[model samples]
Target: MTTQPPPRASRPALAPRRAVGSRRALASRPALLALVVLLAAGLFGTAPASASGPASAASAPARAAASDVVAQAPGPLVWADEFNGPAGTLPDPARWNQEVNGSGGGNNELQYYTGSTDNAALDGSGNLVITARQGNPRGYQCWYGTCQYTSARMTTAQSFTQAYGRFEARIKLPRGRGMWPAFWMLGNNLGQVGWPASGEIDIMENVGHEPGRVHGSLHGPGYSGGSAVTGSYTLPNGQAFADGFHTFAVDWTPTSITWLVDGVAYQTRTPADTRGNPWVFDHPFFLILNLAVGGNWPGPPDGGTAFPQSMVVDYVRVHAPGSSGGATGAVTGLNGVCLDVAAAQNANGTPIQVYGCNGTAAQVWTVAADGTLRALGKCMDVANNSTADGAPIHLWDCNGYLSQQWRFTAGRDLVNVAADKCLDIPSANTAPGTRLQIWTCTGAAHQKWSPPAG
Candidate 1:
């Protein structure tokens, strides 16, 4: 949350969690049910996303029966704030640093932000509640003359920040007039360079005037104030964002930023989108959470506004994306067809065929963090754990067997760890109906593969 009214740069230099994993899903959803049955039958699926691309259906982190993917090894848990403490306690000071001020946040907000419990506290219900009260609660006076409200703003500026990857938070927002709540970031250069130059990323922001929609924007050197690059996302079914908690995230890379709300990606901003503007987002940034009263964007609260409003935060997580160095997508070979499950079938000993790429899910593949190339939650394996050069490959239950663990190297070979042999197409055939088998590592074109383009 910035001090408003500055030329989009009140200390323009801005800001910028962990390994709290999602719980293992039970037999509650039909998709997961498919996973359980398949795993039990020793069958896993293959690329169904189409031949042209990963496909929109397979994007957004692929949550369909995702629990079944079972990360070969879960990515490193960098930092997390689970907010699991009894009610009325402060967030772990070791992880969170609070900002205390009331200078209207440059946005002409009315809250005299406080560091006291009256504003920020964890409810006994596994949530960090950042409450905004209309009147003073702890008798602490406002920084401005007779301010009418008080709130809390928390940050991880001094604790943690990563250059790139995934950052997410699950939050149920507050409602009513004059409320301005946000989860966002500022560049780490704020103290040295200042606003716009330091940059700002609004991961999630909601104004009381727009309860059904949340906006994501970026504030940089030339695009500050009302002119910042911004966009809005409205919940379908006429659902008010304040009705329930939703996950907000941004997958940042050197070239672009993709925003997701509730696991659905709605926007992707690339260098091309702001061609003339300087891209300041390539640096490190910190995180901030705050609920302001009467910010300029939402105008001042009217009589209809509610007091004691709170933003209930469920969890914040940051993950270090696992190795992709190049082994995690489609496994292609001779003739450029993909290594596929015959007819996209999932069964024990389902022959691994070389078929024309249709971008089908069966043609897609993922080399897990643990070096296992899997489809439909099952790994590519050598039949009967055979090591002979002619041994066939098939879709078998993923048992973490050496036969199931395959590794891809720049040498262009898929080496089965259990067999120490490479995947080969018989006599370097280029037919769509051919099946590939294990063969001595030859560094041949038949042993080569290319992953999906970013």
Candidate 2:
């Protein structure tokens, strides 16, 4: 696991992550073909077709049946990289920023991360292959001196960031001693806030010695490094993750994050899991994928360790909040009162309140594909972007800020994405002009809403 330190003025780096700790025991290895079949049949199940890119290198029937399952598990597809391209070509530059450094990732990792295709490239078979090989031919200097191995680390830091969603990757891991591969994310404010204070989410991590198990963890102030909250998932029947491709994912919401492998959830961490520490994951975070060698957690490669180990990634996909876009109708709250623009005003900062469902222009709310709840050509916004419990709700010109984004949860709660709170009718007042506000999500009746009909 990468434990990179704060970014130095001269260079940006990851905080030192994961310490050597007790791991869950390994199960017996299952047959590779059986695992693949099980994943195709069970993991995908028989869900309706979801919007996704081209199918993988599977048969027509199998691909048609299972290709959309992963994307369907979340909401609508927002971002994706199928890794489809000619052999030896690099990943799409617009979607990834490959870090070129040998800072050791603050974990004493031995690999020199390079942008060269030699370390990371697309295979002709629709996969992004990150190869870790012995010897740094360019004589790259690491923190310890000459680098002994070469690998790749890439992130979407510059291109994309999301607050709550489902992030997933299908990967076939590398084996042998000292191999460290991870699918994780760091808060977008890392450069400004620094280290644990910026938050880290380890969706999936595996050390070479633990072939049957993978870990998921959270790190933030007061509970980071070895003290980070974490859990492990082991493949049933002695399966080695390297034997075949497996899907690793995390479903993240404002209040909790759940980890899953092959579509089977193994652990769910919530605010209470922090033990009074802050839940710093309320903001957006960017994705990271990397393979390292000889880190402190995995130790150095022995003579028996193999050279040229590679992590093969089939695709990476993300889905936004569950609410369907393009839905337009009245948003009814407590006592079935429609959420209205006060006095039917279209001016900015006009208060939003509960009123009778008269089907007037004032009550027409549109759930835009970009996550905004719009009416009168303005977005429903948190007044002044406040995070306080009684932050007022009003109309504002849509600027695509987080404060204007609203997510309709399955529980019928209208959540303000930025503040991680619920839209509420103040004091449960159902009066026609009762101004609305945002308060801590307590699943109260006043916090629930009947979102716009699709």
| Tens-digit lDDT string for candidate 1 (239-320) | 8888988888776667667565654344567666564888888888888888888755677889898777999999988766
lDDT of 2 by residue, 198-291 (tens): 8899989999887988988888887776678888877766789999998888888887787767654556688998889999999999999999
Which candidate wins on lDDT?
A: 2
TM-score of each: 0.61, 0.61
lDDT of each: 0.67, 0.77
> Stretches of candidate 1 above 4 Å error?
1-75, 137-144, 322-364, 367-454
Candidate 2 ranges with C-alpha deviation above 4 Å: 1-73, 323-454
**Range of the 10 consecutive residues with the lowest summed lDDT in candidate 1:** 16-25
